[model samples]
Target: MRLLLVEDNLSLADSLTRALNQCGFAVDCMHNGADADQVLRTEDYALVILDLGLPKLDGLEVLRRLRQRRNKVPVLILTAHGSIDERVKGLDLGADDYLTKPCDLTELEARARALIRRSHGFDSAELTFGPLSYDSVSRVFSLPAGPLSLTPREHAVLEVLLMRGGKAVSKDALSEKIFGLDESSSPDAIEIYVHRLRKKLDGSGVAIVTLRGLGYLLETRDAAA
Candidate 1:
C-alpha cells in the first residue's frame, strides 16, 4: 500500500520510512504540514503518518483541511506531547490513531496495518480468496500447497488486488499504491509484476484478469471464467 508521512524530525522520518518500506508499503515523506496538505489534496494514499509539531503548518490544520474535503484516508498521528487532551483533540479531528514519540517501530508498524485494514473494511488480519490466503500481520501469502514466493514488487501487487477483493484496479491506481515517489513507475512495470504474480499463482484457483477499459480484477477461476 501507499503511505504519506509528515514529520519534521529528519532522523525519525528516515527510520520510520525505512521500516514501513520494509513492511511492503510505498512511502512518501514531507517535512512540513503545508507540503503535506498540498500533496494530500492531489494524491491518494492508503494511510498518512502525521507528526503534530510540523512547521509551515501544524498537523492539526492539515488534518482539518483533509477532513473538510471529505477525504477518508487513515491517519496515525505522532507527537512529542503525551497530553490526553492533545490525543483526544486529534482523535476528534479525524486522526485514526495516535502514538507518543519515542514510539516503538514495531508498534507503529502494527498500527499502520490495523489502520489500512480498517480502511479497507477488513475486520481481521487475514484476507482470503479461493485457496489463497494472506496474513496481514505476517505479511505472508499462502496456499494449501505451500507459501507463495514473491519478489517485493510482486508481493505488493498481489496485496493490493486481494485488498480490493473483487473490485477493478486500474493500472495507474495500482502503480500509485505500490510505487513510491522516488521509485520509477509505469504501466508496463505494473504489468510485469502482475505477470510474475500470475506465474506464481498458477493453478491456485484464484486468478488476476484483465478487463478491457476496466483495469485488472482478481477473482476465483470460476468468477473469471
Candidate 2:
C-alpha cells in the first residue's frame, strides 16, 4: 500500500519513512502541509499520516480541505497535542485514528493497518491468487516452497499486481506507484525489477505475464494461455 506522511521535523520524518517503508508501504514524505496537500490532491494514497503542526498550511486545514472534496482516504493524525479536546477535534474533523508524538512505531503501524483494513473493507490478513498467498502486514509471499520475504520494492511491485489480480497493469502505471512522481528511475529500472520478480515467480505456478507494448499482467498460466 501507498502512504503519504506529512511531517515537518526532518529527523522524525526520516525515521518514520524508513520504518514504514520497511513495513512494505510505498511512502511519500513531505516536510510541509502545502506540499502534502498537493501530493494528496494529485496522487492516490491508501492512507495518510498527518501532523497538526506544519508549515505553509496547518494540518487541520489539510484535513478540512480533503474532507471538503469528499476524499475518504483514511487519515491517522499524529501530533504532539495529546489534549482531550485536541484529540476530539481531530476525530470530529474526520480522522480515522490519532496518535501522540513520541509514540511507539509499532503502535503507529498497527493503527495504520487497522485504518487500511477498514478502508479496503477487508478483514483477512492474507491476499490469495491461485497458489500465492500474500500477507500484507508481514510482507511475505507464500507458495508451495514456503514463505518468501520480499524487499520493500519487490513487495510494492507484487502488491500492485496482486491487488489487481486479473488486470493488465501498464509499466508506466507501475512506475508511478512504485517510484512516485519525482521518479528518476528509468523504465529500464522498472524492467529490471519486473525481470527479477518474474524469475522468482517462474516455475512456482504463479504467473507474472509480460505483454509487449501493453504492459504486464499477473494471473495463472492457464488463464493467460
Candidate 3:
C-alpha cells in the first residue's frame, strides 16, 4: 500500500518514512501543505499522514478542501498540539484519526493499518478469498495446504488483489500501490510479480486472471468454470 507523509520536520519525516517502508508501505513525503494538497488531488493513496504545522498552506485547510471535494482517502493527523479543541476540529474537518507527536512507532503503525482496513470496509486484518487467506499484521499468505512464501513485490501485488475482493484492479492502480509515486516502474515488472504469484498459487484453487484491457482479477478456478 502507498501512503503520503506530509510533514515538514525533516528528522521525524525521515524516521517515519523509513519505518513505514519497513512495514511494507510505499511512502511519498511532502513538506508543504500546498504540495501535499495538490498531490492528494492528483494521486491515489491508501492513507495520508498529515502534520498540522505545514508551510505554504495549513494542514487543516488542505484537509478541508479534500473533504469539500469529497475525497474520502483516510487522513491521520500528526500534531504536537494535543488539545481537545484541536482534535475535535481536525475530526470536524474530516480527519479519520489523530495522533499526538512523540507517539510510539508500534502504535502508529497499528493505527494506520486499522484505518486502512476500515477504509476498505474490513473490520479485521485477515482477508480470505476462496482457499486463500492473508494476515495483514503477520504479512502471511496461506492456503489450505500451508503457508505460502512470497517475495516482497509478490506479496504487495497479492495484497492489492485481495483487498479489491473479486473486483478487477487496473495495472496502473496496482503499479502505484506497489511502487509508490516517486518510483518509476514498468508494466512488465508488475507482470513478472503476477506471473510468479500465479505459479505459487497454481493448485491452490484460486487464480489470478487477466482481463486484457481491463486489468486483473482474483477468481476461484471453480468460479471461472
Candidate 4:
C-alpha cells in the first residue's frame, strides 16, 4: 500500500520510512505540511501519517482542509501532544487513529496496518480471492500449493489489484502506488510489472484482464467464463 508521511523530523521520518517499507508500504515523506496538504488533495493514498507540528502549515489545518474537501483517506496523527483535549481535537478533525511520539515501532506498524485494513473494508488481515490469499500484516501471498514467489514490484501491483477486488485499477494509479511520488517511472513501467504478474499468475484461477483504455481488472476465470 502507498502511504504519505508528513513529518519534519528527518531522523524519525527516515526511520519510519525504512520500517514502513520493510513492512510492505510504499511511503512518501513530505516535511512541509503545505506540500503534504496539496499532495493529499491530488494523490491517492492508502493512508496518511500526519504530524501535528509542521513548518509552513499546521498539521491540524491540513487535516481540517482535507476534511472540508470531503477526502476520506484514513489519517493517523503522530504528535508529541498527549493531552485528552488534543486527542479529541484531532479525532474531531477527522483522524482515524492517534499515536503520540516516542511510540514503539511495532505499535505504530500495527496501527497503520489496522487503519489500512479498515479503510479497505476488511475486517481481518487476510484477503482472499479464489485460491489466492494474502496476509496484509505479514505481506505474504499464498496459494493452495504453497507461498507465491513474486518480485516486490509484482507483489505491490497484485496487492493494489486485490485491494480493489473486481474493480479496474488504472495504470496511473498503479504507478503512483508502486513507484510513489518521488520516483520517475513511466506508465509503461506498470505494464511491465503487470505482464510479469500475469505470467506468474497464469492458471492460478485469478486473471488480470486489461480493459484497453479503462485499465486492468482482476477477475476469477469462472467469472470471466
Candidate 5:
C-alpha cells in the first residue's frame, strides 16, 4: 500500500515512515501542508497521515482543498489538538479518521489499514453508472478526465445514490444518511444538496431523474438506449 505522511516533525515523520514501511507500505514523508497539498494534487496515495499544525499551512486547509478538488483519498489526522470541536471539524471537512499526537504506532497502523480497506473497497471499490465512476477506496466520483468536486453533503448524497445503482432513493433516506442524530436537518435541506449535485452533473452524460413518489434515480440518457 502507498501512503503519505505529512508531519512537520521530522523525527516523528521518520519514525512513522519507518514503522509503516516495516508493515509493508510504501511511505512518502513530507513536512508542511503546502508541500502536502501540492503533492496530493499530482499523486495518488492509499492514505494520508496529516498533522494539523504545519509551518506553511494548516492540515485542515490541505484537507479542505483536497476535497474541493474532488480527491477522495482517505485521511487520518494526527494532532495534539484532541478537543471535541477540532475532531468534529476535521471529520466535517472530510477526514476519514483522527489520531491525537503521542499515540501508539500500533493503533495508527491499524487505523490506516481499516481506512484503506474500506476505501479500496474490500466489498466493492469502483462503481460506474453511465458517465460517472465512483472509487470506493478514494471515495471520489469521477468523469472521464478527473475527480468530481463536491461539497461534503453533496458527496454523501451522490454516494448513496450511486451505491443504489438504478434503484430509487428517497429524500428522507438522503436526509437520514447525511444528517446525524445530534444535528438538525430538514427534509427540504436534502433537496438543496440534490439540486446542487444535479447542477454539477448536468452536462456529464447522466441525469438525476426524479421519481415522484419514489424519490430520485441516476439515469443514463438512454435507460434503454
Candidate 6:
C-alpha cells in the first residue's frame, strides 16, 4: 500500500524509509509538516505516519486541517509525548492510532496494517486480486504458476490497481502515490517501472491494462487455448 511518513529526524526517517520499502510499501516521506500537508492535499494515500513535533507546522495542526478538508485518510500519530491528554488530543483531531517514540518497528508495522485493513473493511491479513495474493505482514506475493518477486515500487503500483480495480489511475497520481517528492523521481520513472512490471506479469493471464491517455487498470485476462 502507499504511505506518507512525516518525521523530522534524519536518522530515524532514513531507517524507517528503508524498512518500510523493504516491506513492499511505496513510501513517500517528508521531514516537515508543511510538505506533509501539501502532499496530503494533492494526492491520495492509504495511510499517513505523522510525527507531532514537526517543522513549519505541528502534526496536530496538520491533522486538524486534513479533517477540516474532510479528508478521511487513516493517520497514525507518532510522538515523543505519550500522555493521556496528548493521546486524547490526537484522537479527537481524527488520528486513527498513536505510537510513542522509541517504539518497535515491528509493532509499528503491525499497527499500520491494522489501520489499513480497517479502512478497507478487510478483516484478513492478505490482499488478494484474482489468483495473485499478497501477505501484508510477510511482504510476499503468491501466484499459482510461480511466486513473483515484487520490488516495493511494483508492489505499490499493483496495490493501487487492486484497491481501485477497473478504474484508470493516472500516471501523475501513481507517481505521487509511489515515489513522492523525497526521491525526486519523475513520471517517466514510474512509466519505466510499470513497463517492467507488465513484462513480468505477461502471459500469466493477469493484465495491467493500459487505458491510453488515462493510466492503468489491473484485470484478469481470459485463458488462451
Off by over 4 Å in 3: 223-225
Q: After superposition, how far is residue 155 of candidate 6 from its true place, in Å?
A: 2.7
Better of 2 and 5 by TM-score: 2
For model 5, how does the per-residue alpha-carbon lDDT over 1-225 read when each residue is reduced to its tens digit? 457889998888888878976665657777999998998987767788999988799999999999999999899999998999999999999999999989998889878877876774544456788889977546678987678999777887887677567789888766654553335679889888888998888777888889999998888884233
* Candidate 4 Cα outliers beyond 4 Å, as residue runs: 222-225
lDDT order of candidates, top first: 3, 1, 4, 6, 2, 5
| Model 1, span 70-187: residue lDDT tens | 9999999988978999999899999999999999989999999999998989989998888899999999999888899889889989999998988999999999888888887787
> Which pairs of residues clash in candidate 4, taking residues 3 or more apart in a chain or in different chains?
none
Residue 39 local lDDT, model 6: 82
> Candidate 3: how many backbone clashes?
0
Each candidate's TM vs. the true structure?
0.96, 0.83, 0.96, 0.95, 0.55, 0.85
Output the TM-score of candidate 4: 0.95
Candidate 2 — which residues are off by over 4 angstroms? 149-151, 180-183, 210-214, 221-225
Candidate 4 lowest-lDDT run of ten = 216-225
TM-score of 1: 0.96
Kindly give the stretch of ten consecutive residues in candidate 6 with the minimal lDDT sum. Answer: 158-167
How many angstroms is residue 22 displaced in model 6 relative to the true structure, after the best TM-score fit?
Answer: 3.2
lDDT of 3 at 132: 96
lDDT of each: 0.91, 0.83, 0.91, 0.90, 0.81, 0.84
Report the Cα lDDT for candidate 1.
Answer: 0.91
Q: Which candidate do you rate higher for lDDT, 1 or 6?
A: 1
Report the lDDT tens digits of candidate 6 across residue range 135-155.
777766777787787766887
The true-versus-predicted C-alpha distance at residue 141 of model 4, in Å, is 0.7
- For model 2, residues 1-225, the per-residue Cα lDDT tens digits are 778999999999999999987777778899998998888888888889999999999999999889988999999999998999988888888999999999999999988987886675556777788888877677689987898656667777887788776687788778777775555776667777788888787777787787888788887754233
